[model samples]
Target: MSVKIEKAYILKSFVINESDRVISVLNEKGEKISLVAKGGNRLKSRFQGKLEPFSFVKVEYFDRGKGGLNSLNNVELLENLQKWIKGDMKKFFALSFLNEVTDRFVYEKERNSKIFRLIKHVIDSLKDGVDLKLAISYFSIWMLKLSGVLSEFNEEIQCLNEILAKPLDKLDCKEPQTIFNFGLDLISKNSDKPLSSADMLKNLI
Candidate 1:
């Protein structure tokens, strides 16, 4: 009966029936939530062009509170990531991969603000023309640490720490592959299996 407002990033969305859409999003605190956007697919719908995946928006919804799907009432766009999505296919894939893996790792209603900020940072770097490999690699390493699966990297601890502390524009990492592989190993050791995106990324490099 009560409505809640949340800032979220659209991760995945698809049409259901003819006029509605089912959307999955990561809230500001890195919690996953599902919403049913009534009539979202119709022309002139309030949610049109605003719920595109990877975009950031403020959403208002009514929680059913019994494990039922939330009723999405309104969406307000906060950021549009279309520049990155349309600029390079490779970068798009990498971002998509990151989004998918994030959805997989972050549990529903679980808050992890650090991870949310990290994701935004990586996406910002990609949009700023930072090397895709480097950005993706950076994302993977942080993800590893967030998941508590990263192995010790004594030699690169300083660089890793610097990366963790500094903004993307300030970073200067020459060999992102090393960090990337370290992260891959961590994921392999922790998850049910390596993320499918790993293989697709390998082909790109």
Candidate 2:
């Protein structure tokens, strides 16, 4: 019953037996981790608001080896990204799509700091009023590139890679559909698993 503490971003959550919930998160190592929050739905639960998706938190959980689901013990809120998501359906959908994509493509216990940094940058950009479609497209391309699924030899791909090299805050992502489409095509061909939020994102745009 040794406990471990780490900083992480809540990615997704689901209720299981009415009172308990399973939370999915990306830890500081950029690895997917899950924790069970007992009685997390109770009105007085310590996990209230702390386990919500998109909130960055420092969490303590029981480390039950690799195969068992860990139990959450405590959480400290770091950032409330949900505050920026409210009433912004487009931005919410875009982030949801990104989260789903990450959850689908990234395997548990694997580390990829580049993709993690890119995700953090895109989230901050969205909060700062950057274009939603542009952020999504830019993120999609870079995520694909970092995952090693996109070809770097192609002229267009090379140009797109150069664009990502710029600091995210300074890069212009205007009309990024071409790169977006290329990334999506690569994702489609490489993975058989479907992104659950993909259709919703398309309809929103």
Which candidate leads in TM-score? 2
* Tens-digit lDDT string for candidate 1 (25-86): 88887888889999999998989898888899999999877678899999999998876577
Q: In model 2, which regions exceed 4 Å deviation?
A: 152-154, 157-159, 173-175
What C-alpha lDDT do the candidate models reach, one value each?
0.79, 0.77
**How many steric clashes between backbone atoms does each model show?**
0, 0
**CA lDDT, candidate 2, residue 172:** 67
Write down the TM-score of every candidate. Answer: 0.86, 0.89
lDDT of 2 by residue, 30-75 (tens): 8888999999987888788778887788999998876589999998
Give residue 45's lDDT in candidate 1 (0 to 100).
Answer: 94
Report the poorest 10 consecutive residues by lDDT, candidate 1. Answer: 150-159
Superposed model 1: Cα runs more than 4 Å off:
151-161
Q: TM-score of predicted model 2?
A: 0.89
